[model samples]
Target: MLLEGKIVLVTGVLTPSSIAFTCARLAQEQGATVVLTSFGRALSVTQRAARRLPTPPEVLELDVTDPEHLAALPEHLAERYGRVDGVVHAVGFAPAVCLGQEDGLFAAEWADVATAIQVSAFSLPALAKALKPLMRPRSAIVGLDFDASVAWPAYDWMGVAKAALESAARYLARDLGASDIRVNLVAAGPLKTVAARSIPGFSQIQEVWAERAPLGWDVEDPEPAARAVVALLSDWFPATTGEIVHVDGGVHAIGAAIRPPAPEPEPEPEPA
Candidate 1:
């Protein structure tokens, strides 16, 4: 029971296959009272996902891109849980044009790119501010991250957004330090989820990761990543902040370049 009696808020849970769903499920198992967030039609989707958790948690309204929803989060959490010990900002999105479609990165419209940044990067601060009133010293803010240090085939602007997110986490850790609230990220490898499946060539990255990740990667397994998130949310990371714990099977640390097989020998020519 790592999170015993703790209250956690988790966002971006749309289905049982979601990484956020796994985090929420594990949080409850560890004795945390977890609540989820969703918006519009997807609220129903998150509700359905909640039912699958060990203990069904309350679903809150939080469309990260919507200012109204962001502004309402504190009051909502106050009414429901009165305090929040940890928060998981698991939300991310980008328009199809901003991804690996025919329109390349340069061709992507500003509107689409902005939307990607707003949801994927800017929302971290927004969430922190909204939930600030409920948190005390040592409260943790963990964000979902994908290694954005280098560009990938189809990730495009979403990759750029993650880069911004990485920067934002550092800045947030600095600013929130006085309040003693820690901010960190869990950079997970690509996994098969409703979100990952949307990327056009995600499977190619998955294949490379599987081959390069020293511990071996699983595109279908999110439990490892989920556990990492839960650990960050717990008391174990008291002195750790502004750090990214890569749970990508060690792929992020390595070159991740798949080598080609050596050419076949020409012994037959010698015999001839």
Candidate 2:
């Protein structure tokens, strides 16, 4: 039990297919007591999904943008478990209009992009800060990430948000390391979750990932990614921090072209 007797908070679970749900499930199986957080209309959905876990965790109301909820989080968690050992900041969002509109690209408006940055990037440090007092020393903070190394067709603002997220984790790691708390990001391969389905042209990215990754990636299997999160949440990575661990089937390393080599000339056989 890597996480035996630990208490972990996982945010952004909207359905059974969500990446956060899988992380919570794995954490429970590893002997950790898990708690989930959701907002407004999705609270019911998250609750239903929580029941499906091996050991259903209590669902808490948390809208990352709500300062009131953020301030109440430490006390809220303390009411249930007394202290927290880890936190999974798996929340992110961006309006569809800002994704990749040709005419609207430059004029898409900063409001949407700014919201995405705040939720996907800045909220990480915010959550860490809010939960710091309740979090035990040597605790860990893990976040979900995509390969933000380059631009994808319709991943526009979200891509920029992820880039900011990667940078934010480094800063969080540096600041939190002095307190013996570790922060890291897991760059996972694509999966068909509610949040992912909301993105435009996500299928195209999924196809390219399958074609390029040498290990033959499975977009449906988010377990591997979840397992990586759980491992980082544990004590195994005691000396690790400010790192972006790539769990993308090695696709990030390979070039996009997977076409077979051209056939050799038939005349060569006759000459022999």
Candidate 3:
């Protein structure tokens, strides 16, 4: 009952296996009214997923990169819920070339890199700014994160985007604090979701989690992370903001147990 009587907006719910899906379910079970968001073609997928939730809340159209959509968010929420108490930002993406590229970070051009950062990192603040008016004092904003402290394998430019996300959260927390709003992120260990599976080198990253995460890690279950998100959305951590709660089974606290692979040797220049 942590989120009792709260109105929460959960974006980027694609399927039942997604962490956002679990967060929405837990919020509802705890007495909160949870609304979801998706955009374009994925809207249908999110709508389908909504049917499986306990209450099957309304799914709004939100393309985090769309300025018009961001502008309309407050009005939409005001029409339906009047006010919002919590926001769960689970949206993130990078073009195929932006991740697991053979050229690594060099493979993506500025256009693609900007796209990744805008959609994944900037969207947090954009969504927050959009919803600020509708959010009541003591309202909370929680974003999903990965441990960006290290260079993750195959993550490429997406890794850079996540680092930006962490920084943005801190600044958002600082400025929003005066309004009684708190911003935090939950960095979860890798999970087996469609998005995770699509990343070519991410499985390699997951392979190390079992040994690195002291308490152990599960690449299939998102409930632990989702539960932490619910806790943050509640008043449990009244003064906690601009912090990252690692739900990675303590992986973020430990040193790497496995060594990274050696780089391929450079080819010798042709005889001239």
Candidate 4:
């Protein structure tokens, strides 16, 4: 019951396999009333997924890139719930050309890159701004991150966008500090979510992560990351902000792969 009596908003839940879906589910299980956001043709899919949650919560239409949607979010939340205790910015995307290329950084034109950056990075502030009115002191904002410190093989522009997101979060935390609203991120390891599978070479990252994570990694299980999000949403992290909590099973901390011990030297049977 980490988030008892809290109202958390979760976005980008396109399917039940999405990490956002798990986050929303766990939030409700922990006693928070959760609301999900989706847009356009995917709204139906999200609605379907919502039914699968422990408590089927209301799903709202929210295309973060749409200013109309962003502007109306506060009013929508206010209508249903007087205030929001937590916000989960789980929205992100990039054009196919923006990834899966050796020249990925330069592969996409400015227009494509702009979309990626806006959705994956700028939306954090936009969502915060829209919901700021309803957020009181001790309210928290958490976004999903992918450890944008290092460039990945096919992550390309999306990786750049995430780096921008990390920076944006700090700026948000700094600015929102006056209001006592905490902002943080959970950089999860690779998971078998719809978004992850869409990336061309993401599987390679998953393979390597599974091999190196000291605490072990499971691409199929998102509960660990989900739990982290709910914890931040709860009053438990009242004093924490502007931090990136890595839930990648220790992969981010290890400098090298944890190779297994060399097979025991075969007992050299000395046949005299």
Against the reference, the lDDT scores of all candidates come to 0.91, 0.90, 0.93, 0.92
Q: Which candidate, 2 or 3, would have the higher lDDT against the true structure?
A: 3
Global lDDT of model 1: 0.91
lDDT of 3 at 207: 79
| Residue 184 lDDT in candidate 4 | 98
Top lDDT model: 3
Question: After superposition, which runs of candidate 2 have C-alpha atoms over 4 Å from their true positions?
Answer: 260-272
lDDT of 1 by residue, 72-169 (tens): 88887888778999999999999898888765698688999999999999999999988888998889999999999998889999999999999999
lDDT tens digits, residues 189-272, model 3?
A: 999988898899877998789667777888989999999999999998999999999998887777767445689999999999
Model 1 quality (TM-score): 0.94
lDDT of 4 at 253: 91
Candidate number with the higher lDDT (2 or 4): 4
Candidate 2 C-alpha lDDT tens digits along 1-272? 99999999999898889989999999999999999999899999999999999988889998888899999988978887899999999999988887756654574688988998999998998899899998888899999999899888788888889999999999999999888999999999899998888877888889888688888788888899999999999999999999999998888899865756789867645564
* Reference-based TM-score of each model: 0.94, 0.94, 0.94, 0.96
Clashes of 2: 0
Candidate 3's C-alpha lDDT? 0.93
Task: Give the TM-score (vs. native) of candidate 3.
Answer: 0.94
